[model samples]
Target: GIGDTIRVSLTEEPEFEIPVAKIIANRYNNRKQKHGIKAIEKNPLHPFEYSKRASKEVVGIGGKNAPIVVEHDFYFENTATDKLRITELAKWKTDADGFPLFTFTDFAKADKISTQANFVLMNLSDFDTNWQDVLAKSQNIVLVFESKTEHSMAEHRRMFIELINNDIDLPVIIKKRYSAISEEVFQIYAAADLGALFVDGLGDGIWIEHDEQISQQRMINTALGILQAARSRITKTDYISCPSCGRTLYNIQETTARIREKTGHLVGLKIGIMGCIVNGPGEMADADYGYVGAGFNKINLYKGKEVMLKGVPEENAVERLIDLIREHGDWVEPN
Candidate 1:
């Protein structure tokens, strides 16, 4: 079953480990659920599935097509040069390579912006109706926010409510500024602040800033992780592996790691790794494929809940799993 929250911890340094975590966290982004046996099919116009709020299209950002990834930095100092930089950067494909850069303090510095600038992000605290007139002339504008603390989910919610009440339909990007903290603490902060907004269909993107002690890549991975958890995007493969216990038949930790190495490149695939029948097929509610330990040194493979192979040798399990994915036409060779 998909849990409300998830955290990935490792013995290696964050820089080395974040890539692996991201490989799993972003698996469900942009993925559509295939219809299975069901008593009723879903209506195309389900209220929760559609939003009346206006979708804004920025260069390289197609709005509701896919959530944009925003990055903040001290890219430009002079207002005159900022305009030139925007043009040069876009020409260089900097904005098109999945991340578009914005200056954190540019709003206070520049009265007018270049047409090449795709998004202007201002803190919710500084946001006012007067600026709306200025932004109305702009192309892409996003509301940037920083909540009070880890328990300040309501604070974030209020900001969005205020925006909607004012009829402001600009996309929002939640920004989290943090000091050196434990991965567990960061995960909680991200899930509560950014994850909550994405789940509510509020935020269209995320920007995470941290002290020099933290890796920038780690922040990007966490942002992607939050978006993935909210089901707003799907960029990588997801795993639904159970914790090992007394019912296990083989070395689950070793087996899971091996399985991940082989099939992790298949984006949007959900692979379940279970210890035994105690939490096998029935437990993997969202897994598209499953590997369950059937007995001592033996495994049962499933395509969803249906058993596909039984009592296969543990040595050949990973290969068999790949074969199953290939048979289902989900396999893609890694470049």
Candidate 2:
């Protein structure tokens, strides 16, 4: 299965290329799923519980902190090449000696394990019973899983299940590496691969690495997007908009864009933009604010499920929505 391939030809150039590794990896992952792995019988603890159980407190990571994004040191230390400011990137924790506090090592290499690091990262693939003693000695250790197999997400899930079964509640970080793929494909793959673990309450943080082809900013945004989608962390405005249809009124797409342009800076706020009243109120039940089409050129604004204003002209709806956010003390001037 790992040797499978299909040929692709370009009509103009009369040249062909075969993506042997991609094909084999996809097939291998698919085949591995035919026989299901054991389900997680024990219900894992809430993310907050795991954080509190951590031996040491690290700001923005573990110990009642929201899940964090860990970027490569180059993005933070090498400011000359990376135009983005350090404040925009992930923050690194350092020891009193001015060295990085986290140590990443393969579990297979017993001699390489670090004893001084505050946060130690060990691979899940090379797990052995002998490492249990090492784990017991470390008070501030964080397991990091980077699956070598194509079916990585599944393997990560399996490792989490094993940890839960054995009563190990050490904070875990999901690590993924990508290369030789377009930026769009990388985003989709990273979200699906890492978001699944967060959805299961299995990971405490996320670490993403990509080849030089992808920018550092893109990688940071992607990590934040995955966390936001999982509902585990909130760093930006969240929008719930409906697909336009026959019943739609006003310019749904244009209105949504305009609303986002104004309110995108409102962090952790859920805004709903719906085409019509039929499904608007019901769909955005959890949204903080809602804008729905009340009539041909009229809009209805809502604060939660309750309607705060009705029959407002469509032209003035965006301004009125801003007023509503301000009235509730949620508005902040865009920086």
Candidate 3:
């Protein structure tokens, strides 16, 4: 059903390619029901976020997040007569009263624009203007940030702020398309109060590809990480368990996995597992419960040397950990 195509070769060469699709026609059941570029996306067992959504309209694959009940888009136009090219906002037009003239129709949206423009577009032709109209019509305008071909994005962002303080109707934000060196861009967008940030990094080419590994993971992690930072600031417990080393005298993997599996549902209780005694306790300093190999064929677990259980197979480790927590009433979340 995905019969979309894109012209691969520009000019007269006439090379065209089929657009990539999920290919499994019957795969998605809960997709946003609407077709075209704007579709409600789902991720299963994944907790991170993306770039494209710019607005959140569906819940993340992780059950922990709230549904993205709302979403929006930002559209820009090049209204300059000759399409001068400037990368800084300082070069844009100014009124007789010295008021800066930039493109965003809403001050809230203007704040979202970055103070710098690392990316550039040649004079956007009539066709480009129509394209912007298409995006605006197809997607709701949460904000609009304007730029002529000739202004530096950096200067534009500063001008946007200047406009806002000068009593402008704020768009949700103003931002340059996105660039490698725009930390200020991030700050402005974060301050815009957009509903959710869904990133579609696949479109950014060389700039994103240069740090593919990070760009790929960073998008989701950073969005969710903000929530994590807030959670950790006042949270109770965390756990870390290493895979069994070659020198592990006991079934450390099975034990660690089971322990984590059993206690994962518990909140505010830190647990650590070590394969050997050398670093087991030290490495688990933050844990309220710890299990480690005391010697060959000898294993030990203690709630502060209380010896909840010992000499158990890895399969039974989770049960033991659970029992220990129950015995001490440590598994309950603080009210």
Candidate 4:
């Protein structure tokens, strides 16, 4: 469940964080999935598959590229050791290269930014002459925005529109902060706040800031998952699952989880798990493959719009789906 971006935090020496971050980033980067318009030419509606979006290229950020992940925060005092540390880390495309070294600075301190800085996090309320001058001067630096408005989506959208209208093409990453809540609520908020921008092709990347009670790994997973749900990035296997109904022949939730447990490693794969034939095939046609309920404890497997197997026993449905996936060379051994 890793991606090209990562942030490592440690209570120990900063050097200790490097190996941990590098190991995870390298493991995922090695399997780096190239996502772009060509990747989702067939059915762009499938959220798990790459979808078409009009996004500008942000070097090491967006545009058919994997979503970049970052650690919580990086504070800099502009010391020689800090410079040495940033140099030692933050190298793009390498094992230790995923964390976007972010430092929060006002216009006054922006000039003292170490060369090791990859992104500068700033608030929109602070946008002034000095900020514009900073943005104008640094053409290559990526800027991440934090909004003070309650309606962050609209605020972020307005900010983006302002930037575009002003001819500021600097790559922008959307920063969102969330309080610890139920996973379901967090997911909903994330989709509306961050997913909307990604869908409209407005953001180069996303950073989710959450309460300390929420684990960092969960935050990373949720960040990547939001990108996947928007059809902006593909990291893990996608599940186009349906809410069960009266016609449902099997437990949609359990079946979907079971299938995901097995095939989740097959990155970019879309698996549709529907409760019945009513809206199952028609709705999930965008998926690469489907598992729809027939009746009387039976299931029907499909490849796109075409049914591949019929009347398979309910117990055998998941295995059959895996077999079908393997038959198509999409299966990978779970690690």
> Compared with the true structure, what per-residue lDDT tens digits does model 3 show for residues 269-334?
677777777766677665688777766766667785355677765545566766777788887643
What TM-score against the true fold does each predicted structure earn? Answer: 0.69, 0.75, 0.34, 0.70
lDDT of each: 0.64, 0.69, 0.37, 0.66
> What's the residue-level lDDT of 287 in candidate 2?
98
How far out, in Å, is residue 118 in model 3? 26
Ranking by lDDT: 2, 4, 1, 3
Top candidate (lDDT): 2
lDDT of 1: 0.64
- lDDT tens readout by residue for model 2, 1-335: 63364443221122212343344345455666464545566745553343222323332245555676777662221122332111211133222332133333333333433343334555553455465666666555656677644566877877776676677767776888888877876886787688877776667778888899999889999999999988888889999887656687788878988999999999999999987899889988999999998889999999999999999999999999999999999999998
Residue 289 lDDT, candidate 2, scale 0-100:
99
Cα lDDT tens digits for candidate 4, 1-335: 54446776432345766766665444334434532111212322343543343344544454455556544543222222431122222343245443344444442344433333356666655454356666554445666777644466756766666566566666677888877455545655676677877876667667777777777778778888888887777788888877566798677767877887888888898888888999889879899999999997999999888999999999999999999988988878887
- Give the Å error, residue 271, model 1: 0.7
Q: Weakest 10 consecutive residues, lDDT, candidate 2?
A: 81-90
What C-alpha RMSD separates each model from the true structure?
11.1, 8.9, 19.7, 14.4
> Cα lDDT of model 3 overall?
0.37
Candidate 4 error regions (>4 Å)? 1-59, 73-105, 108-118, 127-131, 180-184
- Where is model 4 poorest over a 10-residue stretch in terms of lDDT? 35-44
